[model samples]
Structures are given as structure tokens and as C-alpha cells.
Target: MDAGAPSEGWPLDDRGVAYGDGLFETVLVRDGAPRLWEYHLARLARGCRVLGIPMPAEHELERPLAQAGEGVMVLKLIVTRGSGGRGYAPPAAPAPRLRWQLSPLVPDAARWKVGVRVRHCRLRLGLQPALAGLKHLNRLENVLARGEWSEADIAEGLLCDGEERLVEATCMNLFWQRGGRLETPRLDRCGVAGTLRAVLLERLPIAEVDAAPGVLAVAEAVWLGNSVQGLWPVARLDGAGGEALQRWTIGAVHRRLQAVAHEPLGYPTRLDD
Candidate 1:
């Protein structure tokens, strides 16, 4: 649990908790240290700028991270417009709330070995270019789709936009192997551009397209990515899947991603000098 106060406590009323007028970033921390800390902070700062809220320093969240205990972990940082009155008008002297949480992260064992099963969700995403790529708090759509499954076997669920085009998985970005190259949905109009997705595009040769819904069903293999999971393969698909959807279809990119996630410290410094 976070130790930060309710500088914008209830009765005070924060617009974020009240109206989902905020942004968040889930960072992947290993051991007692954070990975790509600056990158995650950069994105969070940008999100605050987008929503017109001032950014909080990383140390502001250090207390919660310390309380998080140990091992691989997830750190969530939420910043919202603090204490509003009645209307949507900004507070005369707004106090932005910085709520943070850190907790142990133990991914399903199967994910590391065999990947996980997934299905196409019925809930379609709404197109909102303004908020398409940012990690905002108004995620009723993701929550609804994620709630569609109760069983633990269902590792993730794919989502289509209002036009029935593949956008992404519930909380991760999607990537498909077409026997030659990698293809993924463009998040310009919908979906969150994941941190791992940014790394892949910046590091590998990939494609950004408005993938048709059937691509997941027809692709040779599929995978999903986020900062935490890196890139985990999709072992099985329950739909009009491709040619029986070859089992354990681990592509080159999949292996590369796994290596990056598990051994980020040993990774070669490929960033241009």
C-alpha cells in the first residue's frame, strides 16, 4: 500500500478517483531496484502534462516502493486533479494526488514455459485518438472485457475496436508472426502503446497496421507484450484459428523478448551513441 497522503482526500475530492481524470504507469521492478525507471517516469510525466496535472518526482513514490517488500514487483503511480467542488472546473488551488503502490509479482508458471490461452472478447473498444495511446485511468472498457473471463486458464483476451479491427490485448500490445515479418495494430486511434512495444519497434523490424480481426485467427503465431511480461506467446487461441494454430509456436521475436525481460541487465547496450 502507498504511504502518500490524501492531500486531495475525499470531502476534498480528487477528479481522478471521482471522474477518472488521471493517468497511470505500471512499472516492472526487479529485486529492490526499478528497471527503465526514467522511461516510465517520463511517460507518467507526459501523461500528467496531457491531463493538465503537475508531475510528481520519482522519490515521492520511493516510500511505497520501499514498503513493497521484495522480489520482482509491480509499481503503479496514479496522479489526479485533487479536490474539486461541484462542476468540472479546475480547483482554484489544485493539489494533485500521487497515489502509488508496490507489490510482489509472481507470473503464472505456465507463462514462462508454455505461454497461455486466450480468446476474442465480445466487448469492443471505443475509438478515441485523443486518448488512444496514453495510459489514462478511464478504463471501463478494459475492465469490462477483462471481466468476461473468470477462469484462470484464460491468460489474456484480445480486443477489437468499434470497427471490429484488432487493437490489442486487454492490458498488453499484440504482435503476430506472418512467417516473414511481424505485424501489429496501429494504436493511433485506439489501444495503449505499451512500453515493451516501444522497445520492439525501436529495436526490431516490425509492422504497424490496422490488422483485421481474422489476422489473429489466421496468423502463424501470436504474442502479447508489456513491460512486466515482456513478450509472452499465445499457446492456444479459441476462435477461427489458423490451420489448427500450431502448438507452442515460439517465433524468433518471442525468444528475443523473453531474453530481454529475464536478463535485461546482461543485454547489450545497442542504443546509438
Candidate 2:
């Protein structure tokens, strides 16, 4: 919250941060632009309609994002109810607050070096059919998942449902190479339907399977995919802490990512044209 920032735009409402009655999209900005604008905007429009918020013009957000800095940037778009009175009741014809922030996307050292160290988080993802796959603002579940282990060595944590079914990684979707086929968990009942995950489903030969906790043990390779993280390898995945950057190499995984780094959605600049 900078001093120059308007207080009204930030909007405080019981339905917003309190109830997560809002939607957001963290657009992957690459080479000074955001990738997958169409998909993000479509999801935003649908979320706003469901939450009863008016939709903002897409180009208003995209124009600024297209003119961002180079190398990896992240454009986070948040829309919420503009300052509501204390009550569960909706604000009649509430003005929607549109907030956009630009931040540098961490270049994912996990993918470049060896692989990210991951562990099973204690937090369990509860199923909510209505808000199951929506990228809403209520992220206490992900917050708790990442907070499960605070060690600097830990890159990410795997979250599972109460039934031990794999939901997703703390902030990304999970994909594994099993039996010469790519399998990802069906996020119908839980987890965020990530933009990258949606693109992968369209572009790659993948199948939605019942990816539970057991899938990790038998799968030949495990990777966490996200708009920001890209595709990170799971080098060391266990409860107990292990060695840093072991002999195991994820070069094959890295090469695969390199092959498709700018292929998904045909780069971010396409949206600008």
C-alpha cells in the first residue's frame, strides 16, 4: 500500500478478503508481456458473474500488462467488491474494485538447477463444488499448506484431500509421468484450475486420473506446473529432511521444459497484437 495508492481502489469489504468473494489471476509475464490473457479474462468474467460483480474491460488490464518490463514479470489482477458495509448481505449494484500489480517472477531456480524439495503438507483440501476450481481470493488452505514446513530448503508442499486424494501442490498443479502417459488429477471437486494446467490439457496428450498420494510413489517422474513456476522437478520428496542437490539429475525434465518454454499459448506477445 503505497502513499500514492488510492484507498478506495484497494476496497475493504466483509465479502472480499473475509469471505473470498472475489477472483484473481496471476498472469505469467514473459519478455515484457502476459501469457494467456484470453483464458484469464474468460475465467475472470465468469467468476465476477457468479459473485455478482460487474466485469471490467479486458483491454484496460491487458494494455498495461503488455507494456511491462522484460525477462520474467508477473501481473496479478484482483477484482473485489468496492468497500461494503459490515454484513453478509451483498451490496446492491456494488462497484467492482479492479487492482493490478506488477512484480518480478522468480526465475524458478528449482527447474534450472536440480529439482525442488517437496514434502507432504498436513493441511487437507476440503471439497467445495461451487468454489472448487475457481481461483478465488480465499487462500487460507494454500497459506496453511506452505506454512506446514518453513525450512528454506523446502520449495513446495503437496496437498491432499481428507481422503488422501491428491488435490495439487500448494500453489500449482501436479503432473506425473506414469506408465508412459501423462496423468494429472481431476480438479472437479477441489484445487485451483490453473491457466497453465488448462493449456497443458489442451496442448499435451494428458489424461485426468485419480491422482492420489499413492500416485507419487509409483510414478516414474513428478513435476509441479504453474504459470509462474513453469515446470519444476521433484528431486527429493520425503517427510524427513534429506541432502541438498543429491546425485539424482532432473536434466531430462529441464530439457523438456526448454522445448516448450515459449510454445504454450504461443507466447505472451500474441495477445498484444
Candidate 3:
């Protein structure tokens, strides 16, 4: 199904809608099979534990996901604490609601081949270690950051935390190459720990660090990654004043990373491969 099959419209008491109390996963489905299914489920389970919501059984989600049909598509799974009362307190025994949605998988490899432009977002991510790295329902910061850009050519917006340290993009994990070393922002303080980013960190010799804005000026190349769109090399980066801060050619490093980006996520791929 293209959307959720809830018996009724959104209940007024749904904790997800009311307080943004839920966890979600966006999976890549190919030929009726979910890619990186285990990783996605693991993240969801971790989120559920953090939010104190009952985790849905694996088969409960697999059954609905299999109904998405064949071919490449984006499958979204959401688990919320169902209906709740009119306060900040959560229900003791929560009955979680599972919702699934499907959407077409449009390719952007053509644009990625040339590279894409990214700009600095004025909005800063709040540092909340408790909520950091979880794909929970609360994403107002991302929504506001993404809203800062209206240009269609600007593929994504780079974000920084309140301390002015580079965290990630609005909806993707960030990676940059410097002196032949690959480094990405450490999501220990804030930012979503995307499934693809996890896989890359495990497979590639990438370092997780707190990068500042100045790091981009010296970077050989920058990348934005997500499960749905994969990895996109940055052609240019714009500062807060809309001035070009850095430019990178789609070089050998990007080509090599792009190769691994297309590999199946069955196991932790060796970096030497």
C-alpha cells in the first residue's frame, strides 16, 4: 500500500501526533525484499527501548512490508505509543500502533555523477545526548533547517550544533575527505545515526569527529548519505553569506566510496574491497 491502512483517521489521542512519541525507519526495498532489514529493525528496537514503547515483533513488520510488491521502493515503518491521555505522562501499558507506507524509488545518480550543491543552514541542532542518534518522531529541528533553503539546486543543507560544530546535513549523515582520510561528524551529542552511515563507518576506515565549519574549507570532497538516496558527492559548499566556501571535483575517493555504496548490505564489507 502507498499509505497506512489504519481503520480510522488519526485519533485525537495518538501520542505520535500529539507529542511526537514514536520511532520510524525508512527502508530500501528491492524486488520485494527489504535491503538491510536487520539493521533497520535493530535501530527501531533501540529507539523503542529509549522511548519506553513496546517494540513490535519482527514478523509483525515483515508481513506488511512484504505487501509492498516488487521493484525498488522506499518502505516506511512507524511505531507509536498509540492513543494517550491529555498530558505529558505516558500510559503505563502502551499499545503501540504500527504503520507502513510505500513510495517510489527515484534515482539521482545522474546529478550525483556531476555532484550537488549544499549550503550552511542558519538553524542549529540542539545538543541532547538522551535523544541523540535515535530516529524518533520529534524532528522539528530538521524541519526548520530544511525550510531555510528553497533552491531546487541545493541538494541539502549542512547543519551545526548550538556550539557551532558541524553535525550533519538536514536529512543525511555527512562525510568529508581530508589528506586522504575520511571523517564524519560524531553523533554522540546529536544527529541521527543513519543506517547507511553505520554501515559505512563499520566497513570503511572512517573517523568520527566533531568537525567545525572551517574543516569544509580544506576538505578534498564532502558527501551526504542516507539509505534512500545513498551517497552524493558535494560539488560546492556555500557559507552563511551564500558565498562558495569550498569546491571539490568528483575524484577517485568519491568513485571508490560510490562503488561500495552500491554493494549489498548483507555483511560488513571489507574496506580493502
Candidate 3 lDDT over 1-273, as tens digits, reads 112473344567888899999989999988788887888988998999989998988878887666678778888888888888779898888888888777878767555577789999999999999999999999999999889878898999999999999999999999988898999999988999999988888889999998788998888888888877777889989986688877888867776776676576332223223
TM-score of 1: 0.85
Superior candidate under TM-score, 1 versus 3: 3
Model 2: runs farther than 4 Å from truth? 1-9, 240-254, 265-273
Residue range 1-273, candidate 1, lDDT tens digits = 122552424344668777887788888777767776766777777777777777776678665666555678888777777667878887766677777666677765457556778877888899998887889899999999988877687778889999989999999899887766778899989898887787677676789998777676567667887887666778887642312333556555566555654455323222111
The model with the greatest TM-score is: 3
Model 2: lDDT equals 0.71
Full ranking by lDDT: 3, 1, 2
Per-candidate local distance difference test: 0.73, 0.71, 0.83
TM-score for each candidate, following the candidate numbering: 0.85, 0.85, 0.93
Error of 2 at 183 (Å): 0.5
Please state the error at residue 261 of candidate 1 in Å.
4.5
Q: Please give the distance, in angstroms, between residue 51's alpha carbon in candidate 1 and its true position after superposition.
A: 1.2
